[model samples]
Target: MGLLMFYEYLSRIEALIEKHDDIGLHNYLDAMHAADIAEVLENLESDEQRQVFGLLTDEKATEVLEELNSDDFSELIKALTYEKKVTLLDLMSQDDIVDKLNELPESRQKEIIAFLDYEDAADVKDLLLYEEDTAGGIMTKDYVSIQKDYSIYYAIETLRAIAPDAETIYYIYVVDDAERLVGVISLRELIIASPNRSVESVMNENVITVNINDDQEEVARIVSKYDLLAVPVVDNGNVMHGIITIDDVLDVIEEEATEDIYKFAGTSDEEVYEHDDTLFDRVKNSVRSRLPWLVITIFGGLLSAKVLASYQTTISANASLAMFMPLLAGMGGNVGTQSSTITVRNIATHMIEGADILRTLIHEISVGMLVGMFCAIIVGTAALFMHAEYHIAIIVGISMCANMVTAATIGTIVPLIFKRIGVDPAVASAPFITTTIDLTGLTIYFTLATMMIANL
Candidate 1:
């Protein structure tokens, strides 16, 4: 259903709750999908969330909880007793449980870990050894594996026993006696193949896998490129560790994208907005997030101001020249922003390489020249209509063209240089690029005005 429909349904449920209709609320929640339930939980008050959650069965509740984001999950779980938390933890996938536990303090993490069964605790401990942004950190241990020597019938039976608890059984992995990944067979192949055929004979040996220490973005790229349901994580010796499912990759994609967006806007990762945070909290966070960037931008503005001040003599002689300053600077900023944004996106997606950087910059500068010519004509016409001196018209037009060309060149090169030096291109944001252009554009405008108008 669309967001509107979901909100409408939530309103009806909220009215029922207000009327003390437990049966109605329970029935409503029971009928909703886990994702929908999670959405409702996100918007509800603390007590309301707990009340709604209580109506769900253990299995359904587990699914709903898993659908919630980290903040929502922590808040909802805080209302549960230790025993209830333990029950819920047991029902979750190992990777998800690890993620949830990692968000808590060390004492709380230990408390949560103690509730798991010995084997589960051990698995979680092993997973916690990896950094949160690595393949091993997010890869679930709940994948079905069978011996390569097993017959199709035996593999099928093995799947039946494990499918109840396994996160994904679509691709059954075949490992050697040493527990090293040897091949993989899809569930369709296992079901349709001759019952007595050996797993080794049917499995595809050329399996694509990621190292346990691989970055999550790299893992996401590999999965996207291969169109995989899950990719196995392996050690140096090809010992299968765990499998990163498509769902985990989706989470990583969202996280990385959000982080990049925040960085582009000149903020830290913690500044990403949350729907549930209080108004005060949001305002406080926004101020904190924006202040650092604002400070840097202000410094850039001061430098531009200094350049303008240095051209005071020329401005005093021809006050009309100052009138065109904003136009030239604004056009330069717009052009630079457009060029840099595209370059940054391409670099992020691995579409731009070091070899392509020069070609990309040249193309952008060429585009700038064409765009600049049109802008200069428009601005020059407007200046002439304002009854400005012919020299003023000529200087303003030339300044606009030159500023735009310089803006495009600088914008293209700055991002590529950042990428080459291992800096995120997204960090070179519009504000930063615009500030740079402003200073340069102003200097060019004043210098040209001084020379052209002096002769007139």
Candidate 2:
């Protein structure tokens, strides 16, 4: 539908909701797709949402429920009957059910799990053995798999019989008798292969897989890097756990990106999402989350003041140095922030391993040196134009170069240390980097000025 037409359709539904026209609303929503109905439900008030949801058939409700965001899904579930909740949960995919269940209390989780059918209950229990952030936690066991010894004809026929129940049949994985992942074959390959040929012959034996314990973000990275539709999950022994599809990876990508963005700002997602539903409460939560980081910055600023106080003898002789202090500090702070952001992002993508970390460190330092030289000339010229003394201009220029190089070096090393110590680089890097660079940048500029001006 056109944008205007869709909103108009939504308006009509909301109008019906206002009028309490249940029959009309039910009839109207019946004609819309489940996803559209889900969108409509999200836009409605809680009472209105439950009213509309109550009108949906079980099958349609299952589809609509799957599409709702986590917060909305949890709220909606709270208003359902125990039987209705179990029925809908039973209709969901094993991985999706586990995801929703994880958000509930431990007692509630067990109660819900107990109501699931035997096989699904077993799958949920098995999947729960892995932490929620790991590959096994997000992977689904519903993908099609073929025995490597099966003939092409049998494999194709097997897929035809099982494809309806499978999450994705784009690539059918091949496992040996030991249930070990040995190969993978695309749907097109299966169709074109000679019927007499075995599944092992045409299947690509070099399978790209994630270990069951691998982090969900790592799984997303592998999927994105390889342009894969689905990647198999295996144990250290090569036994199959399940397959993680592209759809699940999309959620992981968004979660990781949101987390990194928040951490870069010196806060977290929980401070934002885990709050009472009020404008004032949210504002308070956000302020609380940021206060500690800002407090640290305040202390750093005080230390900088102390550093400047000790250099009064130097600044008194060359007051022009005070003017360029901001220029040097700003340049260093900006460069450090840029370098640290890149390092954290690369770490998230698993690209900064043993030698790559050193390569990244050196590469950033080299860039910093070149960039510092370019900025040094500009700032020096500006200092001269401002009619500052020649020595002051020269001192600021040299300090800018040194500070920039040091800023980049610290930015690279700080995140690496955080990662080495098993700390989340994103969560811990930015505030520390910003505070360190600001303190040291001023020290470098003024210390150099102190030494240079003394000789003059």
Q: Specify the highest-lDDT model's number.
A: 1
RMSD of each: 2.2, 3.0
Which regions of candidate 1 fall more than 4 Å away from where they truly are?
1-3, 71-86, 273-280, 454-456
lDDT to native, each model: 0.88, 0.87
| TM per prediction | 0.93, 0.89
Tens digit of per-residue lDDT, candidate 2, span 364-405: 999999999998888888889999888888888898899999
Measured with C-alpha atoms, the lDDT of residue 398 in candidate 1 is: 85
Q: Return the lDDT, model 1, position 63.
A: 94
In TM-score terms, candidate 2 sits at: 0.89
Model 1 lDDT-worst window of ten: 268-277
Best of the candidates, TM-score = 1
